[model samples]
Target: MKMMKNFRNEDGFSLIELLFSITVLSVGLLGIASTIPFGYKAIEQSAKRSTAASLLNEGLEKLKGYQYINLIESNFPDEVYGDIPDFPDFARTYEIRMASDVYSSPIPELKMVTITVFWRVSATNEQRIFAVTYIGQRR
Candidate 1:
């Protein structure tokens, strides 16, 4: 009696299997690549927002240092005023509005001041605005 030996076939992946795996991996990589631009845009927007907020804070601090009497009695200045002076180069394109008023509040003697900073996002006609408020006591 002759016995036949059973040998297991151990070859590399078949053509079909290899092609399918490459196709799937390529698709996944392409999908991830498509999102890169969007991620970059989000990061840019966040940076712009942070810079705008800082500028707004700087404007507020300038108001704080002014004579309390000037703050309470004077209307919001038509222009941006501060020791730091001008906006950083990045923010030069932004439009800023400053408003001051004496309103009927618990503190009638104090003035209510609002500072708003506005800018146009790149490629967008819409305006973005950031604002800060402070109350100043009559000197």
Candidate 2:
């Protein structure tokens, strides 16, 4: 009588090994899936910041385009041009403050102009601010 050969000794992964690999793969996939929403949120916040910066720059340009002679010695609210159109929607409110160096020199100059843009982001009612400064010359 010939003895039966042990054919069960094939070199391959067992059922337990296969199951463990599948479990690990599933966990990794789940971790990746969870991060997707967080990535989207980060992108949204970055966009809001970019919009605020653009709005501030727009305000600065508007101030620069005006007649330089009138701006050289003017003060806050007087030199500010609040009615300029096409402000970005992301900024809920914006303001400009102008300061002059009338006491310093023979030709008083625009010391500084500050532009502030404010906006809210997310459901928690958080706020972000963007500001820029510019100096103008006397025409």
Candidate 3:
């Protein structure tokens, strides 16, 4: 008789238990689904930053190849590219100026080359990254 009673209690999960389990599982799945959009946006932001850094490096490399004086002759133009290019909503610019305040700074012997990469962060806001390097007169 005792064995029969125990068997009756252990037959299977009750209807209330099944409903509770399903409710908990559904909540967990919903929590997971809410994070997907945030993850995708984060990935997008990281890619843009990487491209900006790459553009900065390329600009600096070209500057390294030129005579320090040549770059100072004219103001560098604003570099801009579209989504069709590697970086989306991106514009990069460079400036060659004398890094020092002394009299000799007028010459190109010591120059401060600024490479800046800018991007549209939002509809009304923009962000930029810059690299400053000094090109000394290498005798």
Best by TM-score: 3
Q: What is the C-alpha RMSD, rounded to one decimal, of candidate 2? A: 5.4
| Colliding residue pairs in candidate 1 | none
The clash count for each model shown is: 0, 0, 0
The deviation in Å at residue 43 for candidate 3 is: 0.6
Please, what are the lDDT tens digits per residue for candidate 2 over residues 1-139?
2333444656789999999999999999999999999999999888878876777677667666667555432332421223434533344333433444323444345445555665556545755565646465645
What TM-score does candidate 2 get on C-alpha atoms? 0.66
What TM-score against the true fold does each predicted structure earn? 0.67, 0.66, 0.80
- How many angstroms is residue 123 displaced in model 2 relative to the true structure, after the best TM-score fit? 3.7
lDDT of candidates 1 onward, in order: 0.57, 0.59, 0.79
- Across 1-139, the per-residue lDDT of candidate 3 in tens digits comes to 9989897888689899999999999999999999999999999889888988988888888786677557773646776757326565898888777777434566556777788898887998888899988778868
| TM-score of candidate 3 on Cα atoms, chains taken together | 0.80
Name the regions of candidate 2 deviating beyond 4 angstroms. 1-6, 68-89, 92-111, 136-139
Single out the weakest 10-residue window by summed lDDT for candidate 2.
Answer: 73-82
Ranking by lDDT: 3, 2, 1
